[model samples]
Target: MKQARSFDELRALSGNWLSREALPAWIENGYDQRLELFHERLSFSAQPLSDLPRRLMVQCRQLYVLAQLTCRGMRDDRALIAQTWESVKRYFYRPALSHRWAFSIDPDGDVADPRCDTYTLAFLLFTLAWLYRVQPNQDYLDRVDEVLTLLDGPLAASSHGLIDAVPRPDGFLRQNPHMHLLEAFLELHESTGRADYLDRACALHALFSSRMLWRAQEALPELHDDDWQPARPDDNWYEPGHHFEWVWLLRRLSKATGIDVDQDVRLLLSRAIAEGIDAEGFAIERVGIHNQSAWNSRRLWGTCEYLKACAAEAEAAPSESEAWRSRANSALAAIHDHFLQTAYHGLWNDRLDADGSRLSADVPASSLYHLVLAIMECERVFGRVVPPSRPEPGRMRALFLDRDGVINVDTGYPRKPADITFVEGAMEAIQQAQTYGYRVVVVSNQSAIARAYATEAEVMQLHSWMAKQLEAQGAVVDAWYHCPFHHEAQNPVYLHPDHFDRKPNPGMILRAAQDLNIDLTRSQMIGDNPSDVEAARRAGVSGHLFTGGNLALFAREVLMPRPISEASK
Candidate 1:
């Protein structure tokens, strides 16, 4: 089977799309040439829908979306960001209404929704954070402080957190805005490394932990009462994408603070991966918090969120990276297959139905932020991806083992199938090696044929039988090698002064590399004797001695599942 692209390779690949195609396409066509604000959606024909009301959320998302590309050094559009920030000021920033930003603007550039929602406010702060990162202007700093004062004074919630929105609706308040506020605070903290930003994050995180992060339901509730109590089970639902998004957010927060959130992260990740991602690999939009049922609607951004979560998990826990990175690669593939392509180049379909049919024809420009952030995180974790090529089969690593002592009880070269006794942890060790991307190859010094204790055919038959038994037990040995020739041989055909294939020489390992297309440098060997170590040295592979213990435990240590204690840092 063909190996998937490595995480770095994915980053590079996606980075190209973001820089060369997607961002540029959006720059030229996604923005309203006349209005200067980003259009909320683009038609399938690649035309911007200009008549729709402009949202503060879309403006901030677009500002951040454009600035991120420049921040990553993919493009240098400082002048463009500055120009857009000017428009952001002219359109969204309200001077008359206590300096609170307007929620939306009509086509005539008049304030359509005066009541500033927390979602819009959070995104505006997120934009300012990026704006400051690109260029630390005094005005941007002043604006951030002003927004913070308003949030703490007027928009503040009943006790601690901010209200869902001003002109508080009789409807249940939302957890979505708080999630975004947490995200905004994290961005600010990361950009400035200020204690105040971290403090803000801590408060929001505390609110999330106490209220929205529902451990019992294995999902965060989307709706809550004004007092921060979760909505009734019957009316409550959650987005699996948010679950994935939080995994990345939590990991970032842990980096800023020395707090350990590994357990919580793992729990949220496990539940989302299990229940959120469907059989086809798409992240479903909504799941009933009460019934644990999912909606058929799937968004392109959700798949990107899944990629972000997996990448974060992989970075946080190196030992478990194989599992997490594999999922990340899967998410990328799903993205490439479905969302990244369009009728127009660099444009994407935002939503899909159960059968992968386009549910929404218009692309929401807000989603570009999600997709780009996912690739950016991958680059941060795995390094920037570059051009991809087919993985050479010969470059694959293997776990080479001495058959008798390593895989089974060493019973003095007993050749009969009935004499075989598999070593404890041997089968599990083989499985574990494969889980970590190593092929298991067995090389045995079967000198019994030379001693005339067993015929060559009999030993070959025993090996075949043992392989079958191992396969049945889920321990698949990929290839096998045996040396029939020996120095002192009773059988004339097997007699040799010095057989090159014998241990303490590199012949068997070299032959295995040639026959099985193995990469010797990356491969490892485990045997009970010093000769095995010497043979591995000659073969240019690392060799480990297996003492009397569970084979699985010994191999695990050799594999080096290093804890990522400072991975975030």
Candidate 2:
């Protein structure tokens, strides 16, 4: 058997593939330029299935994806996005139904399903939230308010917090709608910072924890009673995809509320990974509480959820970050091998049989939302830009400086704010570099925390004081990165050999580059230590040794009419 790649490796591979291959493929086949909307489905050969109705939900999803791409600097399709928005408003929204959008419409501009459901409306809210974020519009906000009013008035059940689909009850209360509603509310809260949106999301989250999740098996059911209890028996049916989805959502909720739900997150992820994933590495559609297969079908969205959960868990749990990342890699590999098509670059096999054979040949537009979100998460985790920028990307050039020796006078683990002293002309050097369009970032190795000489808090305080001093000099540091670990430390908690984030490993530099959008090739690291030089080398950036000299003179020499690499050489 071949050895599997790590999570970081997998994230890079899948993220690159999505950006380089899948996104363009989507634009070519999935989107219909003539219709000014995404097609309902695409055949395996990347041809649109025009026979199907264009769903309002699908339209909203594609809009959201496109808006997200635009925000991430992936695509510049604002004209198309604006055109699609007009198409949606002109065709889908019904003035008679109090501005409620129809569920689906035929390509001939006729309504297919006019009944407005909470599911479709939730997606609308989600899309509008992104649209508002991309281009803030009072019109989108008004639409959000109108929909919320409709949901609260005519569509709401007599029972508080329960919403029935307009025109009639569906006879089945599904948790899926509520999940999306939570997602929408979260997005709205993030965009507008309205306390009400967050409050609404909190209520739904409370319901999810109290009623939707089966206490006995810790499984979230697909169907629920009108009272929000599980409709099925404990061993009857459960969705692995929902489990992963909930894991990501719950983590988001916890982050927003500052509530500690780490245990629940861990349990959900553990159960889903153990029971939900089949031998082929696909996230199976439905599984019983006992980990038995119920519905053996696998969907692309499920794997996307799985990848998201893995990324979330990896971020939350540092001790097991590698393991979670590895699981994420496995899921991505499965997606690439099974779901992605070789002939059609961006198209995916939406459904697969238990034996890993393709079941659905049509690429649904809704799945694009899932794929884009997963790719974003991957970029966030791996610190890479999705859909790499072209034609002079907007990444900044950085000057990474070590704090102890390069910025402040090194008096051996100086942690007190009073012990800070700038090197000769350091302030002028930083100002001059900033004037020349370079982001000045400080990367420091603080082993004193591990050695018990100083606490991390004290180190941060010192940095803050240093920043204030620099601000007085009209120079500012863009970011500060520090590694507080040692291979051989008396503190067991801080002891770790070959710590990737410590100096010489380039973890700090790499992370800074990712977070700050710094171009490593054009960046440079200045330090008095060999470890700093090695870190710069590993990060693929040039390194300059700082001896006792005027810092402003060095800055001019380094930033002269030559490549930093050549000048350094």
Candidate 3:
């Protein structure tokens, strides 16, 4: 096994200017074009960006849709979300007069091609399903129904039950489309609680594992010909992004079905890091058999996806999955030091080398949300403190909670410092957790960063004042993680997509986990929103959905269930 690299090694090789030179290009160029295609109003074309072909285009859209859905779920960004949804309808939906103006015909419609490929349809449906869940619009639901109807019509899957590319007579089912469809169907299943969606998702999962995944080689086959055979193993090497997507889905499926695909999952995940990842945690887009320049390619989206995967695996398998946890942390740190800029407070596009010596400098528009979600997931897995609801037997890691609405007063996205008010028992609940001897950590998601209503630094100032007030009452927060990304707001540095440091994205929790070396699975998380609960779940943490209680009372009820201290073996 390759040992993880140290920070010193990274610094020595890249020199000091690596981040300065490479970050700007990555930020300006990476994921934005795709974001503009899906979310922003484009004066350019009705079709989606043509730079990538149809298959990759659909995959990119699906990835973006997933990111947007997660963002909407975490925070309340309804107005701009609605505007973006309208554009999605115009571009991807049917029954409109422009429906006849297919992308393949004149290259002037929503997607680049007038002809709707099976991959395109699947991802489009997936996006529609997520939008429906968030906004609950009848129009969006109806559109989803219509698309499903057409999907049943022309784009039938092969006997293997995999959706076939409509125009192609090939049996080749690509992993990218199948993965999104699985996610889309899983979302539908969750929203509607239908067995059919779950069943379909399961079948797609099986198809991907049996056919698309190469077990012997421990890698994923990127492309295939008409037959379900590998067209080019060397050419088919993919980055860790797709691998991580699969890992997350597989873990979720394992929990849902009580069946484990862990062995296959590990093989694919390890191969991704070992093969695709270079020494300094830079995930190369493409790699050749030997160190050949012909396949020397790199991109930013790949790195973003890899981090998400790492965060996901860390949550799902942190205990027995040391390799995954360590590498994931290493990759995240690399991204932070290299791609993340102090100037923009967001990630750069891509890197020039494995050591992250050359910053690609441009940030891809699509990468903003992807990076945000990644961090949230990471924090969810890593951040949490024990509450007073459960009494600790001994000295334990106590979860320090900020006593706003989190412990009590639900002011609903407190905009002003004047709006700061305490909920009853909030302080007592935290004190209870502390009384039980748990090491306390505080995790909170603040959207004011996006609103430009306040700076994160200012929020910190308010939090510091609040902490003093809490300490006066015998409730002390040990450490705090506050997220400041607001897509709608107008801040130069704090606005837009960010890394894992944000809540609802687990950067803060994960950082706490690393800094404190707390056993996350044994840890506890308490937050006001379902996002907090999800973050806890993502972190493999036991979490409580709380409101209006004494911190001690809640702690006694919640944290007492599990033993606070584990015997060191």
Rank order (by TM-score, best first): 2, 1, 3
Give the Å error, residue 211, model 1. 2.2
| For every candidate, C-alpha RMSD to the true structure in Å | 17.0, 12.3, 12.5
Clashing residue pairs in all predictions, respectively, total: 2, 0, 89
lDDT of 3 by residue, 374-424 (tens): 554554443332221222222245463533467537676665567777666
List the candidates' TM-scores in order.
0.66, 0.70, 0.58
- Candidate 2 residues lying further than 4 Å off, grouped into runs, are 1-6, 384-569
Candidate 2, 204-317: lDDT as tens digits: 888777777777777777766677666666446778898898888887777667767776676676667778887767799988775465688899999999988888887666
The number of the candidate with the highest TM-score is: 2
lDDT by residue (470-489, candidate 1, tens digit) is: 87888778767776767798
lDDT scores in order: 0.77, 0.77, 0.55
In candidate 2, how many Å is residue 118 off? 0.7
Give me the displacement of residue 282 in model 2, in angstroms. Answer: 2.1
lDDT of 3 at 194: 62
